[model samples]
Target chain A: MYGIRHLHLRNPGSWSPFEELERLQASLERGGVALGGASAGPAIDVWNEGDGLRLRALVPGVKPEDLEITVEGDALTIRGTTAVAGPQSGDRWLLRERASAKFARTLQLPFAVEADAVKARVANGVLEMELPRSAAEKPRRIPIQTT
Target chain B: MNCEMKNGCATVAEPTVAKATPACDVWEGEDGVHVVAEMPGVDAAAVEITIERDVLSIRGKACLPRASSRAEGEMDAVATGYVRAFHLTDTADAGAIQASCKDGLVRLLVPRKQPAQRKIAVSTG
Candidate 1:
């Protein structure tokens, strides 16, 4: 391991031991609180696959009816919400860690994607969007005759 | 001492806010069990739904983006609230539960477990 001074320079965001412990405790406490107060969970991972770009989002509990996908040029916007179901009930719960509220995530594509040919599917709590490259944007090859 | 004794019960028994019971519609058919939740503003990514032993639990947060003044002039779409729940039920299949969100409605399909197969022997006639 590098010296403490060198390590601190390399990782500017590194906190002291006390600070780290405090942060850990804060996170645990936050998790124990009611759902809405905690931070957003995971972020979507996107990649470019030679011929096209594939975007995958981990949207676990949302229903098919509560999601909407919109693409404007290279920017994609996913908007939707899950409704709280059930009547008011009187009960006492020791702990509640799930968040119940609305949220939206938007992303700008790095490369130009064929907006018309894009396809999306949600299965097993994952949303996958496949965006193919436009004909004009795809790589072209030239064939030469043997001299 | 007298005031403490008189209000001890009152202090311990603070009136609790009546928690609202989430309204959902559940349907069971040969295909699977379908559950529809009416959450308005929650995002699909923020929602966590699980089915264990036939009990379905859905939890997620909703954060509506602040509308820009320019966009307000162009469009009139309003976002509402969030969606969270721990549904305790035996009607749904715990092993094969599928969920999706669209617009403001959440639809869940929990397929029942398949039955075991029995071996059948055929004798030459």
Candidate 2:
């Protein structure tokens, strides 16, 4: 889920009270998930678990040092830059299909992430993370007695 | 597997099952043609590259843990794996093909064939 329930679809003539904020959120989400359009950044898979979320993003050839991950509230942002490979300096390219750019994606999760418990690592051109839910955001089981 | 069916694969290509097509870049330079592909979740040990006749096949089984989830992009191959193959040109030399897989990325180089060399004898009449 993109957090917001109502969003003005891309109809040029449409406008609403939350239009400005929705537009900004939608644009930022373009990097996060493909809600209704093509994703500008890497493909991501987010699983909403009972306690937290598991996220995976494809980023081949991107080194760990080149990535920047930051979390604020329920939103998590992933940014990276890639270097295109070549046989030599003056090699002629026959086909260039891979993305070679500075890209960033921000995702809005359902619960606040425990920053200390979150562990992220890059392997085989993919970024994987486990975001544990904050204690305050976790649901507590209340005891009940027969009355 | 020097020769095969029209598809160039000695191993049977499963027509019923769909596989993930990896994103790749092909360039001609240095000794020959080089190809690079982005295949996340695939490891070096899991990558399979086969050359039969003029066909170069790349297949990798990518296994990732995801249970009861909502995802995006081509998720089918996450369980089934990735399948891709290339037909080599006549000028390419298959004998010296060099390939390496690292961190879910595969790079292949097909060197150009060396030209025939022969010395012509000159006679004085």
DockQ of every predicted complex: 0.02, 0.16
Tens-place lDDT digits, model 1, residues B11-119:
1111222111233555444555455654444557756675444234564444433322332111112223332333333433466678887644567765655656899
Which residues of candidate 1, in runs, are more than 4 Å off?
A1-42, A84-88, A140-147, B1-125
The predictions' CA RMSDs to the true structure, in order, are: 20.7, 12.1
Model 1: lDDT equals 0.48
lDDT of 2 by residue, A48-107 (tens): 665788888777788899889999878888877777666478876665678667777777
Worst 10 residues of 1 chain B by lDDT: B1-10
Q: Candidate 2 - CAPRI tier?
A: incorrect
Who wins the TM-score comparison? 2
Every prediction: chain A TM-score: 0.61, 0.68
Q: Report the Cα lDDT for residue A27, model 2.
A: 53
